[model samples]
Target: MSLQAPPRLLQLAGQSLLRDEAVAIPAVKELPRELFPQLFMEAFTKRQRKVLTAMVQAWPFICLPLGSLMLTPELETLRAVLDGLDVLLAQKVRPSGWKLQVLDLREVDENFWSVWSGAPVSSSLAMSQRQTGEDCPCTGRQGCLKVVVDFCFGFPDIVLQEFLMHVCEWAQQRKELVHLCCKQLVLSVRYVNEVRKFLEMMDLNCIQDIEVHTYREMDSLEQFLPYLIQMKNVRKIMFRHFPGCIYCSPRIGAEIMWELISTFRKLDKLQKLHLDMVNFFKNHLQQLVRFLKNPLVSFTITGCWISESQMDRLFLSPSIHQLKELDLTGTILSDFNPEPFQILLEEVAATLEVLILEDCWITDSQLNVILPALSRCHQIISFNFCGNQISKSVLENLLRHTVRLERLNSVIFPVPLECYGDNFDHIYWERFVQLRAWLMEILRETQALRKPEVILLCTLPCLTCGSRASYDLEPSPCSCGKLGREP
Candidate 1:
């Protein structure tokens, strides 16, 4: 029988792998015999003992079964113990300065969710059952596979928080990567640097997943990126940042990070790239746009827009024709003239399988031009158009054209409101009703798409009002003040 190392697990906790000294492990190794008798137990041989010793010493924490539980007569039991230990070491210990990697979750839940849920699920509705109380019908007898309810509100809670650094060693033996979550990362900037160095270490090769999320800037990232650029197995990378991420200011931001990201070209095996801000994206707009236009298995852009030059380069890239998933939200397409964007759809609309346009400046004419071309993207399964101008005629026609579109996301128009010049409170309810009727009339020709498959998310009496003119297309949060409907 052939033996294979375990797969990489996602690093979530939001703690930098290098900066968290408590977790930044030097290479795996054995402690002096005088220190731990737990490994000297007769059940563990020289190899098994070597692996066990490394786990606890590698990191400050880990999650595992009780200490003496594996003192058994079974070889299978011993193997399970050793493999888990090996994975633990792999995640924490690394060589000097060569391999930093990151991975994701789809690899972990392979068929595990089936065992957990006890039934096969295909539809979105079927998979979205997080409610509790009743025994899961999928598991006729077992109920839910795993259920632990505790109000531990923070980190090390969702993941292993105890001092069992031993768990890392156990994972190393099996040749698997450990897992971490992003939300668990709640720390100051000073410590995030530690994660960078730990990841930069060499021995920590063959990784599966690691995510480092920061609110403002990833200043420490520049140092270790060159090492990560060498990982032969890095397939997916997801970066989440908050607000403008001012680190990305005009020419300087992109000019600096461009060199760092250039290392990404080393991962000839990469399939996914998820970026979270519009600012940093602006720097590498042209190259980033071209990179996205390729055979990427999945692409998602939330609240980001393309630059003028990048939009021009997009037309030249043949990769734009092979994308599988695409998502864009709160994008400012109007900043530049909408012509290049229009030219873009004319070429790639037929190849797009998934499209999301929310809070964008989409005119009815643009939608009309793209409709026939889009009908050919037969694989389209998800379409989210929340708050954009869709001509009543095109919208009605879209419903019919979306045959393979499994999830046809309907629209949420800006709520109707009347502007009361001086006294904002005196704004009457009748004014809104009248405006609502008028807006509906604007799309009256295509109001027939309110059926079951199309999810129509509606919100009215919203404090956020609409534009006085027909041009402004910006997002406004719900401003529901203390004023209630007039009695």
Candidate 2:
């Protein structure tokens, strides 16, 4: 009953151009400036090597976001682009229309391509105007073209590794003409020496985000600290599987901690910090918090345990008072006194947007203690308290309190104990359905305007599949749960 529409005139022309690379290659110089992006996208996606290379050499835009088109690392395409750059560099006098300065190898600028490809003529013109108005930092500097990239050092892809090696060598050959800027760097401990060598060759000041994953490496963190201290412009740092002093002496451990804290002092621009499975900092957290020079916008400490005193010190720290995102997921706080956490909530309530306390084993009494401070967070957009134990009445009270916070959009809560059977592995289906209906009713009655997505999570995983079951304001069960319901 439906018919397929014919291809647009532009699409047919692009296809015809792609059918013959020789003609397309020569026509790039005389082609309309607006057609470059759309045609380049088509050539790049279809792997028209010669045409793609020609377009790169004669590109009219200041930035060529090649990385956006590269969904997977393709060695041949990269080589062709580099070859075009080689031709561009070899020119004694660049073409009048040639404006390429930044070859951004980051997955960005999708809208630029989309607008030029099929958007309205007005949108395409507007995009071209905006691109013309934007200025590059390396604009006027002689022979100072920038090549921006994000590197993940430990990925197990040989083609990607080879592609990066070629790029590195190319940049090294033209160091004066090319500025290789790495914005986000993820380093695995196994490749510390290689990463160090790479970092030494590039400008460290260009790095904005860095993540270090030490997979139980005893001395990797210490070895990397010297290099980390030099990244003064880094805005965020994350440490995962950060080890303790099980393999080294206490004095050596203290020395490493001191070195780390010193590195923190050098990163004055740091605004976000995450430490996951990092038990080594439990004893020195207060000192670390004291050394932070700037107020953090996000601080996440997951899968690590710290004492009540350490938490109290953290709550009192001025560096975290204005936090917008706070995550304490999997950090046991069942034994912690509620006063410190309540105070922390109140301190950050005005700015807090995302608060995740999943798997903290919080009890009904603890929930009650912090509910008042939690309700005052007017900017809270997402709140996750799954894996805590609370009663139906307490959860109802919690929902009622959150109703006044209009910015709340998502809330994940633990299924009340009243919905479970003698043990958590078995669920009372009838009770769960009734309790969920009641909670929905409460939200409908209390919420004046916006209604947040409320999900009830059962901590126990399904016996058939290892996935935990969650109810989204409805009794719809997971696939495994549906089998259990068969009569």
Candidate 3:
């Protein structure tokens, strides 16, 4: 008697699990028959009369699960069905713990949208799904979700209510969220009242791991912050760039700064914040410097033009001392003067264990001045500088200086080509091998720390953060140990 097979489905998570959440879940497609299917078909070919029996004997799916994230019906239905089958088969499997938290925004309040416009927001629904004749799982609101959809996806009205409505609806269902995620979807301003209503449902202790995207509005973001600070469970808040803003200016207003600190002050249980694109104005660095004094794990300041004062606040802000990982790519190195660049390295070099600077203008000359200061930062584990204009010499020098660097990229280490074994391209391969070998020589001799992997996401924020979204923020973390590793 052959063992039975479990029904299978397809999803894209860590290991291609049967499912994950909507925000993180990718579109599902049928499993490729070439690999598993063909093998299964062949095994059952001799048993046409028992095709179903053979399928029942084979493990027929992939498992890529996101434990805490939520998913939509379309994605979840397929996953649940397959997961249910897996359970029936009693196979060795670990299904995802993610559930469906689809928020339905189908109603409207248009008056307020005319006032506030263009807010940055989450790309997915903030609250769980809504339908008529349904009672709330958390608050038991029947037949009425209180807040209706205030804006369409592309209309100007959409921008106004995006943050306010999405947050309000999401907050209304807070009791259901045992897991925290930084999330919001602001589509229009008419939903402002909806958000205002959400504040009334605040349970500071219940909020955890909030993810928010900042927008261009000078007043709107500041307006609703009071509600955010109230959520006590929020441990980490991620501020992302809104989807539409890609080519806009990289400056910010003063109100944004004040409100950011004010919000930070409220999160008592908060341990990490991922702020992206908080522009530095001369006057505001004073405030920012003050804000960084608070303890945090991770900090990300991407794609902003920092005034000298603002730049100083970063170094002076005692926050750098506490942060475990620091990402400062996508920001201008002051096309005005490279001196600030040097100052930046001096400020963050020693403290940053995990460092990322991709596609930046910091040349070999600049890094030469910067990396040596990091000699004391023995914890420095991972470092990435992909797409840099740095010369091989500068790279070689950096490898020598970073003693504990476990993970490195770009100029970190070179890979030899198999072409050396071939006859056709041996000449080119020979030159390539010689050059890369020299690079590898520096890599091995430096004996930099030896982590296995690193990621490269440091593109210019004007490009990384959306131009339309222009929701600027500074991301910070309280993570522990080193930057990244060699890949």
Candidate 4:
């Protein structure tokens, strides 16, 4: 074992100063700029409220990432930091070397701390410049201090909820001097009124990502869209568990769908869109695609049925031509024609990095239609077709095609039909082992530039234990299968 090194002279001196707040508070202004971060980190960690407040008042840096040091939310620590700002604001003459403009309360700036702890100072300066780039709302605004925080409404954490509420109230009280910048906002429809009021209080233009989770009536979304439309800088939007408008009249449902699709036109910077269990967009996909003004990098639609025409319209949309990630997990397509989807694959082959079609129920013939296009996706990194039924011959053909994808690293395919009995309950483990071995041999024979790390053959979940059996280089059976029980 190696002996640990003792603390540096500067660290020991700072600790001694912190032991007496009366001396430390007065010494903060006279202390060297380089010692602030290290000393502040120690003071924050020890919850020395007065020292932290004094350090914040004399902070020399342009951005202080206090949130990074907060491993867990502490109301006293947060209140201490805010109270320092309150003191700083009331001062008639700002302290010399007072460059603090952004107090970021987001969980970031780990690099800032590392660089301050002995790394070159220029590297820390460069990171600070990057963090406070031109996009920063308070970048050159005189006497305006921007406080950045990520608000997650309707979360179950009581302490965090209280902390956020206090921050909101403080920001509201000093609106003229402070700009509350929220880049990411998550809203649960259960607290619709609270979220609405929160959005109204903050600057919406600073928001870049927004997610809405709804388990109630569709009107919750209808009520929330006005606020969403104002977030012009939002790059990603996700709607999860958005209920269908079955309780309303058909005409009223159509109106709500129209309102929802029309709101996308205002989000010119949107690059990623995800809709899960949102059934209202079944026939309105074409209208939605028409409103998207920019190309999308990621698109995900799960557990939503689409008709043949809607599928064709989706593939034909120009916005999806540059997609890097596409996930259609649980979107049934066994009966739909595959020609339109084939065109989409061909269109996005150059840029597509991830493709997931798990539980889509695609047939062998449909897979054949897209195999040529799939083979050309040279940039593909991950591919999943789990829960689809295919014969051994077709699976072999699929593997042969995938061997050409040099960048592919993961491949998850369903076990071939030959390894199963009349139903998925009766899995032929011996046959599965044989087929997996054969497939491995075939992969070895192909000799691609890069082989996938995960080449798994998955089966349906065991009826008894609800565990799935997967065959890779070795077979892993579920508990029921290992016990020779009927599952």
Highest-scoring model, lDDT: 4
If scored against the real structure, what TM-score would every candidate get? 0.52, 0.91, 0.51, 0.88
Clashing pairs in 2: none
Instruction: Please give, for residues 168-200, the per-residue lDDT of candidate 3 as tens digits.
Output: 444354433311222223322223444554445
Candidate 1: stretches off by over 4 Å: 1-166, 169-192, 200-205, 208-218, 242-255, 289-294, 335-339, 346-351, 390-452, 457-487
lDDT-best of 3 and 4: 4
Candidate 2 lDDT over residue span 276-306, tens digit each: 8767777887788778889999999998878
- CA lDDT scores, all candidates in order: 0.41, 0.78, 0.42, 0.82
Each model's Cα RMSD: 15.7, 3.5, 16.5, 3.8
Q: Which lDDT tens digits does candidate 1 get at residues 1-487?
A: 9996542221121123323324423323323322222332221333343334344333222112222233322334344444433453444444332111211111222222232223464543421232221321222332111111111111233232221123223323332233321111122222345434333322323433434344444554554465456555555666555333455423335544676557665566566666655355554645754543235665555666566576556544554545666666666554445555555555555555567766666666666666666666655656755556444445555545554343444333322223222333333446544544554454454455432243332222324443221111222223443232332
Whole-model lDDT, candidate 2? 0.78
Worst 10 residues of 4 by lDDT: 243-252
**Which one wins by TM-score: 3 or 4?**
4
What's model 3's lDDT at 330? Answer: 67
What is the full ranking by lDDT, best candidate first?
4, 2, 3, 1
Q: Can you write out model 4's per-residue Cα lDDT over 1-487, one digit (the tens) per residue?
A: 9997888776887788899899999999999987888899889878899999889889988888878888877899989999999998887687777788888888866778877566455465654663753475555677888899888886678898888888888999998888888899988775787556677788888989888876645576688888888888899988776344333122227777788788898799999998787666668877886789898999998878778788888988898989999999889889988998999999999999999998898999999999999999999999998888888999999999987798999999888889887757767767776787898799789774567887888876667787777777666777777412234
For residue 143, give model 2's deviation from the true position in Å.
5.0
The Cα RMSD of model 4 versus the native structure comes to: 3.8
Candidate 4 TM-score over all chains jointly: 0.88
